[model samples]
Target: MKIRKKPPQEEFVSQAVRTGGDGQDAQEIAFIDNALFHADHAEDELFGEGSERIEVADWHFISPSCLEADGPPIKTKVLTPKQEKLLFLRYNYARRRIRQAQIRGAIRGTFESLMIWRQRAQDARDALVNANMALVPAMLRRVNCPNVELEELISEGNVALLRCVDRFDVSRGFRFSTYACRAIIKAFHRLASRRATYQKHFPAQYDPQMEKCDLGDRIHRQRWQDSIEWVRDMLTDNQAKLTLVEQTVLLERFAMAREGKGMTFEQIGPIIGLSPERTRQILRTTLRKVREAFDKDTAGPVQLAGA
Candidate 1:
């Protein structure tokens, strides 16, 4: 069986830069460029269709730098006269609206007009973002945060880029790239700090089993404390049918009070002037009544230490 080879891509020229080509190829390139130039001006018209021509310059395989690695930075490419003029227009548009918003801060109907100007400003800023995407990778390489992925750093840099556009002062004569780079670096640091704090609370290698055991222990301790509180309240209840001697015996026998040592019947019997057997009988009867009351008041029986 014979294998079929793939055909060449419709795009012949790879990039904006020129390379050695014959007169025929140059003519073809010029024709394609002219078509695109007209297509870009058409509104709501599909490319490669009636009254529309395809865009193929950006579709080709070309390094954004469009120059030698030893040459000037890629961000410098956006500093052309046309781009500068567009940026100036966008800046002035946003500036006029900002002043208007301030003047009409107390007015109710100023919002819609302010929003329109803001949208225009954002469109202009987005153009700047697209032109300066090369700067993001360069800055991320410089930061060298091993923990963060290149994609995450790029996303953070994009956010910082938007913020920089909002705050950039064109009158200062400083390049937008310089201001945006600083903001992007700060964003990277903030993200790293947040990740560090989160890791401190919950480490990367979390264990659900350990957490489950800790939860169980906490629940058990809570139940034990509730049981102790219930017994103490029962002993102190003046309306309960328990006699005075029985209350004293319960409090002393279970260490419910600070002075209690959970004394045996023999020890408590002499203090109460009763036989040890009689004291034990009263203690058992009082505990049985308390247990019954506790079961009735709560969902389940309390776990006595030695029932």
Candidate 2:
């Protein structure tokens, strides 16, 4: 068989990773646009067609173009493999530049460069978060959480993935997927354990007293209010029947029967220009007539001992 000559690795890879007007490969731009920006619903374009769409708001990805665009708010999304590789290169390149600046004792220069490097690192980290989002759903599938929804599980996993990206060491010669899987699963267990703890410590109890006590308290307040209103209505209705002197005495002595703080005859005597004994006599006479009228108005009127 005739042997086919292999092209240079660099040239072959360069052809595969073609760039577009946005300085990103056209295929990568398409991937990011479809997977992150253009997605109308929570569909998984990352793993290609037939993948399960995690019915949720895709708030995990942000496009670099939107970094300076006067457009709608930028949401975070996962990165494609090629995009991740490029972002990784950019981050590491910035790191090396910062290191070189520091080594040369360029303190002022390093400070300015450090800011740019930090942003580059952030972009790389965000890219990693976007790319490995599928791992969150994958991790959720392995766990058993009866109470938690698949969406919640995925949410927890995404948090774990972001944290994993921050702490991940690329020098370890392992794929980010492997590291993130364990972290996401651990996060899942932590979530389940927290829920278990809550259920164990503060279990839902069918305490009849809770409802009964609240209802009883409300009822008591309502009854007390009703009693006060009824007494005021009774006092107002009978005011016309009394003489001016009697009316003044009743209002001053009983305060219209609102608070049950009826004054003694001695207290009312000076206020009404009557002697203590005379005030007592008038009060006693008024009480009998009022009690009789009150009893006539209602079937369940309170029976006074003397009246």
Candidate 3:
């Protein structure tokens, strides 16, 4: 891997000098520039062209292969113990470099270099993760989780595998697979525990029939019926200040007092001795007056009977 060189700090130094107002600003700028320069030099010395670089190729789990009775074929060339150690070393070293840069306050000036190391760390981590991808399905075969889907288990196992790659200590001389298996099983156990808790709280599977509740609907319908009765009383008592013809048009148009459905303007027109348009006009006018009266009655402050 070719490491990128850090950009010269002189550019920042010159820009700061041009914009700075006093010697204090200039001194601070120079101090920052010197720290960044040393930091860049240290990074180059550590990871530059002379260092041994490990190349990681893209690898993925072939789903069809995972179904085999024996085990899934390794997607990439299986790393030897030495290669695995090197990859882990590189990954952790890159992270340490980033942390050191952050501590030294060199990150702001070395953003590009930091990103390159981050990408290297990610690549190394991915190589380890992909090489061990088969372990997930292999472990899954031994697990019996009837409630969880195979896909969800695989997903959880993959996440656990990635986390294991980050946390495993190659120096401890333990095989990565041994460490990874425990983590993946714990992940599955946690998933199972969550599923158990969820089932405890909600024991029954979702059933549309069982979920159906009509109490709210009944209450809403009763309220609507009461409102309709109140409006009928208003029309009957002439409390809405509607004229006789207006009242007749509204009652017949809406079928409020009659048994059948409401009449259209054309049907109510002949009964009221008016054209359809005229009947529609009377209905609109009656509705507006009724709405005004209803609004006034509802909006007014209520009084106690004695008061």
For candidate 3, lDDT tens digit of each residue in 252-274? 77666878777888988898799
Q: List the residue pairs that clash in candidate 2.
A: 60-76, 60-77, 61-75, 61-76, 61-77, 62-76, 62-77, 78-130, 79-130, 79-131
lDDT of 2 at 239: 37
Query: Which scores higher on lDDT, 1 or 3?
Result: 3
Candidate No. with top TM-score: 3
Clashes of each: 0, 10, 0
Please give, for residues 110-137, the per-residue lDDT of candidate 1 as tens digits.
5455555556555665666666666666
Candidate 3 lDDT (Cα, whole model)? 0.69
Candidate 1 deviant stretches above 4 angstroms: 1-77, 85-89, 98-116, 206-307
Q: What is the C-alpha lDDT of each candidate?
A: 0.58, 0.57, 0.69
lDDT of 1: 0.58
Higher-TM-score candidate of 1 and 3: 3
Better candidate by lDDT, 1 or 2:
1
In terms of lDDT, the best-performing candidate is 3
TM-score for predicted model 3 compared with the true structure: 0.51
Instruction: Provide the clash count, candidate 2.
Output: 10
Measured against the true structure, the TM-scores of the candidates, in listed sequence, are: 0.39, 0.41, 0.51
